[model samples]
Target: MQLHELEVENYRAVRRARLSFGHTTVLIGENDSGKSSLLEALVRVLDGGAAEEPPNFESFQFHRDPVKHEIVGPIRIRIVFREREAGEWAGEVYAPIHDLLLRAGEDCREVAFELRAQPEGEVVWRLKSGKRKTSDPEVLRWLREFTPAIHLRAGMLTGYGTETLPCAPGLCRTGETELDEKIAAIEVAAERLISKTSPNQESDLEAGFKATRELLQLVTLPRDRKAPNLARRVREILGKGIDLNSSQPTLPGSNTSSEKLGILLLIAALLRVARGAMAKEMEPIWIIEDPEAHLHPKSLASISYFLSDIRWQKIITTYSGAMVGSMPLSNVRRLTRRRGVVTEHRVDVTQLSGVELRRIGYHLGAHRGAACFARMWLLVEGESEMWMLPQLARLCGYEFGVEGIECVEFAQSGLAPMIRVAEQLGIGWHVLADGDKAGQTYIDTIRRTVATKDRQGRFTLLNEPDIEHCFYKHGYAKVYQEHARLGGKSTRDMDPRRVIQRAVQTLSKPDLALRVIEAVAADGSPGVPDVLQKMIRTCVKVARSQSK
Candidate 1:
């Protein structure tokens, strides 16, 4: 079964929010933006509280109004699950709840699980099928058995014992009746031994006491006693015998890094599923938080590949840029909060054609995925602006990193796909274009892509032909003049623009940009160009507005 959708109300930072899911969903957001809360909500309702004790409704778990600072009541989390394929729900485990599966569409079956906190500080779990609803705990048990949730928290597998592998009984059990018979015999013998060792011979004790006192008569009181639970003892014995050294070559011992240990745990879980320990009718949903923790970029890419290959439904939360870039753009869900209310922002890949989708994915995977985390995107033509814009923004008293602005050089994938992605992800974008023909094309694309009302603030055209020319025309003419003389090029009677143009053609664009920024930093006389400063201010204003 796959998680179809989730709705949360008055739970933690999420006042009210609804989220849809696919087979694989990557939750990306800043800290405390409800990512962990969402995952916790899923674990609470679907995992059947396996990983944790039953949640006591803490006051902090309730949503507090940002303005009034008063906690709310009845924290609710609802989840919907549907079959991954048609006619796959034919197992005996699904028989009891067959009637409870609601018809979603053609060959589609769905069921909803709702968990609500009551005024008396108690939690209520209910299963729903269309208009029919029941609080029967048996149905919840059936749901968990049919499709269990595997929640792997961060660092859960880092410090594991290697002497005895902690694994499912199915992993170590052999299909033989002899082991069962021997365990049963041992249980019976142990119970008899306990009975034999008890003080049952009262006559012999009285004879021994006869010498001490002749007149005193001793009596032993008859008392009822319970037998020891041999079955629980057998389970405890079996738990210590199961180990992974024989199966997993590199066991996740104390020496294993947290990153590799997580991957190993996932693989072990999958092995259990493969070995028929888990139900075969539906794959378990894996709720993993920070799978990218302590992983290198290359390792993140490898893990992403491994995760994509698994057919099970996975909900992962991450803060790593490489992790975001490695996954498909459609799988990413960006979360944001304002005034103590969380909202989700995602790209609607359904509206994009296959080619457009591919283009966006290519850009994201090409190390531009960090743009998904940015509040604003400064779309530039090439690397020169990409390298120089942030420095210039700082000169104008705007910190790009602090303000969550990313300079995306969209020369490879063109402008349309990047703009579409930014717009869909709720990231504000502004295009800085040259005055040349290629730049005019960018300007025209922005006009056609962005709404007419938003075009002026989102698009800027430099007065000169390009960045090099613009820098010369604005305030850095002397820097270029000195560079031209050092390069054996006479600039005594040359046009100032032509001099800079020759310098750009000969020197690398990025190198020249660095030189110009360094010169401006040393001089500290002429500030950033007025047009560029205005553009930066406009980007900040538009980005913050869009975020709100």
Candidate 2:
């Protein structure tokens, strides 16, 4: 069951925003964007408060100074649940959900929720102020009186170091219960493998016998079939009577300490799995904060796949693009915060090109395979190129990734952050840049990044200040392959070299030489020179609209 959509009003940094979330949503943004704030609100509203508990609003950052005298206001959280019948997504639109539902509505399905605030900033999730003496709100009264659910920590995995977990006992790395479960499962798995080698039971007899005995002992039952002579009879059957008496065995084994720790870790995992089984409602949406933190690349990859299977609608937060790229494209959520109110967006990778392509490349590599991926990287100036160049590479039909050809738009602010992230990712990179003089500075910055590579293989810098120039320089042989659908021949003669000439000819802002370049590159068809010239004028109008 999914909390298909959210409508929050005047809650924390989010004053009023309505959003639709996929079953598995990856909530991402720079720091202090309302990602966490949004989750907290949902958890509280979903919790269906039992007793009066005031929401702590101290941490909420406001875009405006709320009236000091105000209180007793309404903060509404509306979650829509979708019902799917057979292959189609059906519907029974409920206001507030009682619990998570896979296909909408409780099995006995009843849904209505209402919450109100108090004058002193002590928001009463249920209802009432004695002076007002009104009856409890109908919606809140029903939910509070009849059905309710446990509000999970929006992020159960918040702190990186603390071992405490929310699900169950022995879930912590050092928990004992987890260890026992692991030891049992491991024995089962290992013996299953061992049984393969010893089809006749000669090689695995002792181990299998031990496992059977231990498993029996774990549940405090007797596997020996003899009640009185428990230890003695069991030991004799395994042919280890002497060692049993000595309280030690002579056998190849993993260290007890290591195995014990491993068991605890195993149990912790099992407990989390069990949490779903035990939930009173639908399987929970596991909210995670940087699940990639402090884990090995291989482990992170495995975990990434596991998380993808969680099936619970999720909201994963991260500061690292590695985690972002490791995630599927459909799940790439980009939360944008402006002024003080926070909003969300899906990073539509399809619209990105050139530099944006590289950013995504870094994101994919960093998220999936390595926390620390390729070194020295190229930082592009825009997101569009990052979005499309993989298409460019595909058009050229060159297989890209395996050859270590990774690139990403560093960030549009400047080449500085891009270079820094590359340095952090430990990859040396060459940059393809715009033709303007300022771009030279970006080029110099990138050249310095690969200062260490063997001088010959040092850095591969490819520049065409603009793709048009790139089109201009490499037009003959590859142009057809790159923009294959281009119906016309190259219009190199009409190409504008300087920003000023194109600006003067095109009534548009002559200031942006790049616009003229874009116009020429838009078409490669014959007799398209008129369109190219017109494109310059169109681009100028576009620039004017943008400035306005």
Candidate 3:
């Protein structure tokens, strides 16, 4: 069974949200955007009742209306579970709820239940299927056991010890008999010692205790009872201790760094989940928060790979770009909060072909995955624009990093895929294409691909053939002339365009861009080009408007 979807209402910061899940779903958003709250809601609804005491729904768990300044009640969390195959229902764990499973589509069955917490603090669970609803505790129990949800909070790896390895069930199974025998031997020795120290023994102390017992016959005296055996309690503490194979045999949490411990814990959890599934004992769902916390980039990639390889349904919340880049764009759900309501956005991979999807994934997962997190994307042709445009934006008093604007170089990866991603995610984008034939092709592609209502303020074409030519045309002729002279070429009578083109061909694109930016910064004679300045302003305006 896999978690299919979650629908939440008036839960903490989320006024209402409906999110669908993939096998390995990643939740990403800004701080306080309700990523943690969403995970908490799932944990509460799935495992709340399993505890010895019922979970208390605190007042703050209810959503507060930003405008009204009042808290709302009756928080609702509904979850849907889909069977992986028709035979999954035949398993003994799911047999009790087999009749309640609803037909989702052809050959697909699903079961849904809602957890509602009323204002008066009463929580109720109702199973829903095709007009038949019931508050069956049996269904809830079956659901909890069939797919147990485990939440690993941020920084939890450091708190674990060798005796309590998260994956001990799968990792340790060989030393039980030896441990039990040793514990029994110790218990026997402790019993012998207790007998020798007992007050019931016929010693001088026993005689004194008997005399006292005669005087206080109504009260129970210590002489009549044997001593308690304290060694029996050692059985609970003496089990297999996991050795991490370091210089010193110690637990990961005690000796290892947080980053290494995180990786180890994840590997252990994956093993346990896999083994449990195969043994038909349990199918656990992991809710991991910030698996990339304090992890290096390489370590982050390792965790991402582990997550992708695991077959069990898991949800991860992360704020790392490298982590985001490692995941498929289709599996990521971007969250945003506006007007006290949390909303989710995701790429509609259905619109992409197999080839296009692979291409996009390769580019994003390899290099440009961070673009998905940007509020706006400035699509450029190549590295020249990627490097130069941000500097220009800075001169215009708009910093791309601070403004959450990512300059995506779309030369290697085509523009259509990026446009599709941006449109689906509601990220404002502006394409800066040159004025040559290729540039015109990009413009035509945008017109054909983008919606009519979304075309405004989304593209800018340079008046010149390229950025280099634009610099020469827009009163920055001296910038290139100086470069030509420095390169041992006299541009006394050459065309300004030719001079700039030669400089572009002589120096690498990035190096030449750096030279131009340096010259512009040093001389301060020709400020930012008018067209480029306007383009930056337009991008900022579009980005801000879309954010609102």
Best by TM-score: 3
Error of 3 at 409 (Å): 1.3
RMSD per candidate (Å) reads 15.3, 18.1, 14.0
RMSD of 1: 15.3
Task: Please provide, for model 3 over 411-466, each residue's C-alpha lDDT reduced to its tens digit, 9 standing for 90 to 100.
Answer: 77689888988778768899999999999999999999978997888889987888
Instruction: List the candidate numbers ranked by TM-score, top first.
Output: 3, 1, 2
| Clash totals, every prediction | 1, 42, 0
Worst 10 residues of 2 by lDDT: 233-242
- How do the predictions measure up, each by TM-score? 0.76, 0.43, 0.78
**Model 3 stretches astray by more than 4 angstroms:** 48-55, 102-105, 158-262, 265-280, 485-489
User: 1-548, model 1: which lDDT tens digit per residue?
Assistant: 67899999888888888788998899887786777777877766665334222345777788877878787668988889877776555556567667676544468677788888964688877778788777776677666655666665653222222122234322222233433343333223222322344153233222222211110100001120111222222211122222312322221221223333233333332322223234335456767677666544543554565566545678888888878888889899998876657778899888788887887788877768788899899999888899899999898888998888999988877798888888878788889999999999998888887778877777899877888888787778876776664466577678877787666766767778888998778755577788888999988787677556
Candidate 1: regions farther than 4 A off: 49-56, 90-92, 102-107, 157-282, 484-489, 495-498, 544-548
Backbone clash pairs for candidate 3 read none
Question: Which residue window of length 10 is worst by lDDT in model 1?
Answer: 215-224
**Reference-based lDDT, residue 159, model 3:** 27
